[model samples]
Target chain A: MYQLLNHQRKEKLRSPFWTKNILMNILLGFLGLYLIVTALVVSFMAAGFIREEFEGRDVIEVFTAFLFYFFIFDLGFRFLLQQLPALSLQPYLTLPVRKSKLIHYPLLRSISSFFNILPVILVLPFFIMIVCANQTGLYSTIWIATVFSVIITNNFLNFILKKYFVKRPVLILAIFLVAGCLLYFDSIGNAPLSGYFAAAVNAIANLPFLFMIPLIIAALTYYFAYHLLRKNFYPEDSQTTRSRPESYSFLNKYGELGELIGIELKMILRNKRPMSVLIFSILFLAYGFILYDDPDNHFNLMLGGFIMTAAFAVNYGQFLFSWEGSYFDSFMVNRVSSFNYIKTKYILIAFSGFMTFVITLPYAFISYRIGFVNAAMLLFNIGISSVLLLLFSTRNSTSIVLEKSQFLNYQGTGAMQFLMIIPLLGIPLITYIVFLILGIQQYAVFALGAVGFVGIIFYRPLLQIVVNSFVKRKYVMSSNFRKK
Target chain B: MIELNNLKKVYGTKTALSVGQIIIPERDFTGLVGNNGAGKTTMLSLILDLIRPHSGAVTSKGKIVPETDEWKNYTGSYLNEGFLIPFLTPFEFLAFIGSLHGKNSSDVKDFLNKNRDFYTENIDSSKYIRELSAGNKNKIGILAAMLPEPEILILDEPFSNLDPRSQSWLKMKLKSLHLEGVTILISSHDLKHVTEICTRIILLEEGIIIKDTKTSPDTLVELESYFSVQV
Candidate 1:
């Protein structure tokens, strides 16, 4: 089993999907490492805060008391991001490999997950502090063992949780709502869950034999996961997998381009990655509360203006042409002209920017400056940023698998996408900054709006340029999309 | 009519397609034949403007394929699964295709009814094109191209995944369309069907056209003997 995993890793590294654009891969790798190290440093800092708050009490008891919340937080995150055991186990199921051993492979693999190690990384230093503080070795050791057992228990519980929730997604929402209600009750002191947790932690430390509870829980969870995997490992029966017809006809009322937009909308709603991005774009509307709450910060307001107006554009536009990667060839050979195709994208995103602008009007009620700046930014994003994104999208040929979760997957992301962000967001922000430094700070907003209006006025010429570029790269894009 | 003038396409060091000069006249039932890697699909792609040639051009009715959208108004083609919008149902797909050529949903329904025999199963019940079996998916593609009643039709391996009954239905459909002077081009490895329906057959080997001739009664026997020698 270890050899099989090792071979899969090596084969994955050899695939062009991983090895392409070596420099970009190295940069993203470094960025990831930087984030992890920063998180570790933050955890180290948090350990000090814990000691200061819980002074005069045994640090082991306080830290152990907090361990339950940590496990809950980690569980929520792992549910969202931790990949299912997607490795093809079907091939081994046919072999002489024992079902017990096959199930154990994924269980063992789950323990090595980055998510399992993250909590350990955060809490390990706190335990070391307790050891340094001259606590009883046996008591400290029991606390440490209990925390690790809790982490392991959560890890195995995740496998069962995900397997069940995948078949019934509404159950996932219900579980989250229940967890939220528990936390709410505990917060309002209606339920003293925290006090109960602290008492349990003290019991585990004082009576070292009580550590057996979490150990038993961990063992049972692992057993449950094993049985679940064994029973549900094969493909679902055809009856359960049959798909019902789903139709969307709202956009058909607008004629042919409306039909195209309707398809695009359906694609976004139906696919996992696009749906997540769409949701994220909506959530980003709340960013203005953080940025514009203080009216004096012009810099933050400008930055917020860019992000708010262009939220949908950035999230949806980055994968503009690639979003249609699945059926791009069909579009190319169909009756749709290259110009009309580019025009349709421009109108769709421009309209999205307009809608985002309208939804953001409430921000203006908070502060007139935020309101006016956002209005200006909305114009700029629709006219300039959206056009730039559409033009750059003509160059994107990577075929993205729409089924996979988008968060941190980065499966179809390429160097060009990263580079395109500069022109899409950078130029407009730079134009605003340039005008601001020249003592025309108030006029800067209008300048940005004017530039955008100019872009809209000459939309035909701009679309022609995009159309030509799309035609030039059409063959390469089609061939690349065909690769997967 | 489609004309390929000094057309060439290469991927790195290998030539995928190279046609010095070729003309497929209007109303001709032409069949393209080749083994794997023989550039049959590549040639069809170049003609349909799915790929850009390294040199020269393909023109349909005196309009360059890439430079003008005029050819698309009359051209209906299905090269592979890439030409399908897999998320849409067959009914939606046919409707969308019909709309592109000024046909309404009723027109598409009429077309479906006209060619019900070509679809071996009830396609309207399927949720999406992706859920249908391979044979059904091919039926969707072939019928979609034929929905517009195009002046020019190109299909790559139209008979590949179809059942025998569907294949005969398609052959009959294509024969009638050919009689009505709708130009048709088909690429297939099925020598029997190609010989039966196509007036002309072109054989390709390793990116080069080795034979282009009118089909006769003995065309299938001749092709088998020729391939037996080549192998």
Candidate 2:
């Protein structure tokens, strides 16, 4: 087991994904630390906030009532973000290690996931501040133990759910249905399901012996995962099913560039990683609902419009050439010209931005300001931001494995993507803010549109610049991509 | 015609390929033979403009490959599986490759039909290129390279992963293409096949060309004796 763990450590350390770019690793590390600190701060503040919000109710009761909702959210978050612990166990299978130990290796390794730590950070400070401050040490200890066990249970259950039910829509639909019903009942204020959960947790806190219930539940979930995995432990059983071949013959009429774009669209739809990015972009279309609720905040309105229209372009375009890294050699050697290649990517990304803009145009009904801002941002995203993203992508040489899940898979990420965030968001926000300072915020929005219109006019020259950069870097990009 | 002028490539401290000059004339069947790490792939990569040389250039028809995209119009090369898009099926991959060279789907279909004996399975099946066996993948890659009826064809170890029957079929196909005046450049470890088909052979050792000669009846014996000494 120790040897297996050591091998895993070496595997991670030696993976070219991390060893290639120490800067990206450092950036990710800082981002992770920032999130942890933010979670801790939120946890500490929650106690006082709960007391103030529910003035007449018991503080512990309000906190415990919300615990159920938090757990559901945690489960959903894990479903989206938590990567299943996979080790290259075929070699170990032939070795002297026991089969159970081999199974336990991955399961045990999963406990160290950041998802497991996040809940503890979120709950620890709040629990200590509220429950421990008022109650006896024994009572608070039991309460904390119960919450920790629930968290562990959630961690293990998430593995099972993701392993077996992720591809099956029925289980996911059932979970969503139950969550929706609970939320609906709670909103209507009739026998709220959260009230019962809070009462149950309070009862368990008062009775220290009942802490064993959550502990047992956690143990059962772990054992259940173990048994399921042990039953179907062969590596062949874990292979992803082959995707059906798709034809885009209709795109032929649009010429070679259309076919290229069709190929990219197929790549995104058929691959797991790019599909996840597409899903996230679609979800970001709802940004107006959150940011536009406060109609007067023009800064957020501009930010929201930019994000909503350019979500796909920004998320998917950052790793534009990297997506085709696998076949870049073939692409280069073939009759495809670098200029046409760049144009294909530009058209695809900008077209996606245009589609998103039209889809989100209904946000105008909320307010004419929103409509105007979205229109301006849409032009900016397609004309300026998309061009900038394509330019920056030439510097990214990291190759991405399309088959892997996008969640926490940083295969194609480089420092360029992190640096790109500043200019991608900064330009619009800064331009809007400068206009607001001059006391003509409306014209500032109009100015954003004007800049984008100018960019659109000179898009041919901008595309040529991108193509030139790609041409100069093609050898390096092709050689780097060929490494894996 | 392809010309390499003082072409050199280095990886870290080791020079992977260095050639003062080697001009491959039009309609010539040229073979590159070497051991592992002898830089056969590197030389081909430089010629394809797939890798930038240290301080030299490859010019086809007096046009620098890196400086211009004209060579790609008539040149087709596949060095490895990196040339194959794994997500697309063999037919789709061929069609895409064909489309790039102004060939329509029917043209691609005709090419596949002509090479029907080379494929052991259904070429138009839904199986993605990645899911195919190594030999089938190689076949798809080779077929895609030839689909454009390119004037210049470059392949690295085209016979390595092929089955025995497919290998002979490919040999015949190459001979036919050579007869039709298509310029062929291939690198292989199989001396028997290389000597049998190639009119000219270049032996590389440690990034330097050791022998460049036209194939005669005794050339196979001479090459075999040379390799036997390395043991």
Provide the TM-score of the second chain in candidate 1: 0.96
- Stretches of candidate 2 exceeding 4 Å from the true structure: A35-49, A124-145, A164-191, A203-220, A227-232, A240-243, B229-231
Pick the lDDT winner. Answer: 2
lDDT of 1 at A51: 69
In terms of TM-score, the best-performing candidate is: 2
Judge the docking of candidate 2 as incorrect, acceptable, medium or high: medium
lDDT of 1 at B167: 86
The TM-score of candidate 2 is 0.92
RMSD of 1: 3.2
Question: Highest DockQ, which number?
Answer: 2
**Candidate 1 wrong stretches, greater than 4 Å:** A39-47, A53-58, A65-69, A90-101, A131-133, A157-196, A219-232, A236-244, A285-289, A355-368, A440-443, B229-231
Residue lDDT tens for model 1, A124-182:
77667655456788877877787788889888898788777754545666776688788
Clashes of 2: 0
